[model samples]
Every structure is written in structure tokens, then in C-alpha cells.
Target: MNELKISILGTGDMGGAIATALSRRTRHSLRLRGAQPGSTSALRLIDALGVTEASKEDFLASDIVFVVVPAASIEEAAAFLNGYQGIVVAVSVSGSVGRDGLPSSAERIATALPEATVVSAFTSIWSNVIREPGTSGKTSVFVSSDDDNAKEVVSRLATELGFEPINGGALSMALYAEVMGMFAVRLAMDSGYGRTISFHAFNAG
Candidate 1:
């Protein structure tokens, strides 16, 4: 894919890490939108990283949108792109969601904005792993979307970000994908592996 106009909501840790990695990897135009666009970190990204602050119209006009906010803010992020008709990739995890819940963070966002083509991806790995170029090991990113075309777009982006993207089936499968991510987190926290480790899938040939 050529230059894509991308809009990212939320400017916290994961958002900042993604922006940093993407800025280094792709020259695609990026716009940061959130409750605090004029904050210190936002200004740094705007001035130092060449990221622009986008308005509601600008956010809606972008080719692809990424919702990087927390699980609790999924509804607000959906409201941010209420009538948008483009692809939305939700990287945030549905932390409090129970096992087998249909509405994961990505699913909930899709539900809130029924018109949007939302894909669940980039959640099962750490931001640090995404920043690397896969020299050591590749992190497997699970992608779930009802729209095959949108899923393809996100898969390409994942490859560009140095991850091995795996199809997690239809949008409903996003529930399982997110649960897997949470399980990885639990493993890291409980097993003393720390956040540096990632969950990966191997293809048996």
C-alpha cells in the first residue's frame, strides 16, 4: 500500500510507542486525536515526530483509523468515529471482559459504530516488540475482522511493523484473540517472565 492517511486516538503509552515505531518505519501521514492533543507528549510528537493534530473532520477523513485507548474508553473511541466508513484497527485490550465475551474492545467498538469496518489486531504483543525489526524473533499478531479486505489491509500493516499477522477468523473470533492476549499477560505476570516476552504461534509445515 502507498501513503495512507492514518488517525490514532489516544496518546498514552501504547499509542506513543506505536507512533514512535510507525514514524521510524513508515512515512505515512499521521494525525493524533485525543482528549489532550495539546498535551506535552502530543506536542513532542507534533513537533519532533512530524505528527499533526487532527480535528473530528480530519479524523473522519483519514484512510485508516487506529483506536489505541484503554478498554474502558472503547465506547468513547467509537463515538469519535461514529459515522466513519473506513477501517478501524483497535489495538487496545478488553481487560475486564469475561472469557468468550462477544464484544471485545474491538467488537464493542464495531458494535458502537456499525458502519465502520473494524479489525482486532496488534493486541497480543508488547509495544517494545513492535518497535523492533524482528531480528531476534517475530511476534505473532492476531487479526480478526468480518471484512476480509480490511483484514488484509491490517495484515499488510502488521507485516510492515515487523510482526507475523495471523488470521483469527471472523469478527466474533476477536473475543478469543483478546482472551489469548490477556492470557499471555497473565503468564508474564505470574510466571516471572516479565513484559519482554511475547506469545507467538508457529505454523507447522
Candidate 2:
């Protein structure tokens, strides 16, 4: 498989896990960066995997951009990449939701990067779930986007990263996916459940 060039805008646990999953499953070349100033550690980590440590310019060159920063930082980050015409997929891994259960920052991102295709994905799957993969284990991801091409791009990427992509479709469906992540994270953190859980589909028919 030809490598997909991915740029991850954050290099925390979630970002790192996503990069690792992509590296393992697909022929992907990742360019990772951190929102924090002077992220030497993040640079070093991704570089060790033969992934490039990217600056703002390098990120803009990617075929796909993963925004993994907090909701508050989404606009700022999006604004920083105003001219980059690429696929921007926001992963609301923070599990924080607003009044409508939607990721509070998605609208800002969608508006700021008007030329970019913004899709919501990797929001339902936890960071820890990607850290460890078991035999026959699977992570379910809910994806929402108005652009069918962008949705397909995310869906293919999700499958490559060992996840089952559930096409929730349209940006409006983001609320459900974001809320699901919140509940999943809380369940893992507060309850006895481990850092991961399987989202299964059972047809009653």
C-alpha cells in the first residue's frame, strides 16, 4: 500500500497513539507536531518512529491533518493554517462537549478552515485502546462529515488504524460521537472498566 502522508497537530497520548496505529497498519508517513511551545519531546518521539517532526509549514503539506488539541485551541490552530487547502479531520479526543453535546470547537474549525474538509472522527475511541491491540480486538469510531470524500478518507484511515468506522454522516452527528467518547472515558477513568471498551453492533433481526 502506498503511504498516506498524515500530519498530526498534537503530540500527546492520543496523538501519539493515533500516529502509532497509522504507522503499524498502513504505509503512512507521519508529520507530527505539538501545540505547546518548544515540544522537543514530542518531536523526538515521532522522529524515532521515522516520522518527521513537523513545523507549521510541514503540517500544511500533508494530505490529511489531525487536530488533536483541546477544544479551546482549535480555532487558534485552525487559523494558523488558514491557507492550507487539505483534509482537516478533527479528533475530539478530549471528551468535552458543549450544550448540544457537540464538540464546542468544531464550528470554529469548520469556519476557520473554509477551504479544508473538516471531519470528526477518532472521537469515540479512547487513546489507550489504540495503545494495545489484542487478537481479534477492535476499536469502533464514529465519523461525521458533510463531505462524502472527506468521510471516505477518514473511514479508510480508520480501517487502516485497526478501527471499525461507523458512518454517522454529516457534521450534525458529531454530538453523539463526542458524547460517546466522554462516557467511554468516564467509564474507564471512574469505573472498574479498563482503559478500553469494545463498541459492538448486534442486530436484533
Candidate 3:
């Protein structure tokens, strides 16, 4: 694959981990941005990873952008990408219902940024696993989007990052993906399995 310019929007755990993984595992040109301007975490990751820190224009110019900010900040994140017309990979899960009668976070982002092709991905994988992919065998990452080409691009990215990407159908499937992510979180926190676990599909047929 040709080197694609990718940008990550948050500098929190998930965002930092993703930037680290892409820098170490792939040759994609990465741009890092924070949910807030002049974020310390973003600067730390940029210094540590040697990736470019994104300006608003840089962020909008990326071929693929990952919004890894918290669910509560979805509107702000969407507003930042108001006119962007590229693939947007949404990693946060929001429970609020959108105007389209869906509670999927990706759908909410899509509703906000009508020009951008929204793809739901990486919502299930824990930040630690992204930071250290070799700790286990290939982990499954459910990729869902209304656009096939956009989904393929993200799936290729997942593969490059040492993950197995499962096609979770259209954008509506994001609701179930979010639910599955929450279930995993519950298992990790309440069931004593910890955050080291990941979900995979078994082909019993």
C-alpha cells in the first residue's frame, strides 16, 4: 500500500497508543492532534514518536483521521472536522441517540459531519493491546461503515497494525459493536480477566 497520511485527534490513552503503534508498525505518515490545543500529552507523544503535530489544516488534510476522544467530546471533535471530506474513523462510543434514531457514536459523528465518510473501528480493543500488539495472537477489530472503500482502507490499517479486521456490516452495526466493547470492559473490570483480553470470532463450521 502507498503511504497514506493519517491523523489522530486525541492525545489520551487510546490516541497515544494508536500513534505509537502506527509509528512502530507501519510506514504511514502520521499527524498527531489533541482534543484541546497545546495538549501536553500530544506534545509528549509527538516528541516520543517523532510524528508531526497537526495544525487544523493538517488535521483536515489527512487521508484518514481517527477521532479517539472521549464520547462526551464527540460534538467538539465533529465541529473541528466540520468540512472535512475524507474517511473518519470513530473510536469512541456514545449512548445518546442521534436524529437518525440511532445511538451509535459513529452515526452521531456522521450526522454531525455529513461530508465525511464515517467508519467505526477500534472501539473494542483496549489501549494496552494497541500499545503492545505482540502480547497476543492476532486480535479482532470490528470495522463498520456505510462506505466500502473507506472500510477497506481502515481494515488494511488494522492488518498493518497486527489485527484481524472483521466486517461488521453498515454503520448501524456500530451500536452492537459499542455494546460488545462495553461488555469487554465489564469483563475486564468486573470479571477479573483484566484489560489484556481481546475478542475473536470462531469459525466452527
lDDT of 3: 0.88
lDDT of candidates 1 onward, in order: 0.81, 0.76, 0.88
Measured with C-alpha atoms, the lDDT of residue 56 in candidate 2 is 80
**Stretches > 4 Å off in candidate 3:** 95-102
In terms of lDDT, the poorest run of 10 residues in model 1 is 94-103
Q: Global CA lDDT of candidate 2, please?
A: 0.76
Please, what are the lDDT tens digits per residue for candidate 1 over residues 32-117?
Answer: 86666587767767776787888889878988888988888888778767889898998888776565444788878888989889
Q: Number of the top candidate by lDDT? A: 3
Clashing pairs in 3: none
Q: How do the residues 25-55 of candidate 2 rate in per-residue lDDT, one tens digit apiece?
A: 6787877878754597577666667777777
For model 2, state the Cα shift of residue 62 in Å: 1.2
Q: Best to worst by lDDT, what's the order?
A: 3, 1, 2
Candidates 1 and 2: which is better by TM-score? 1
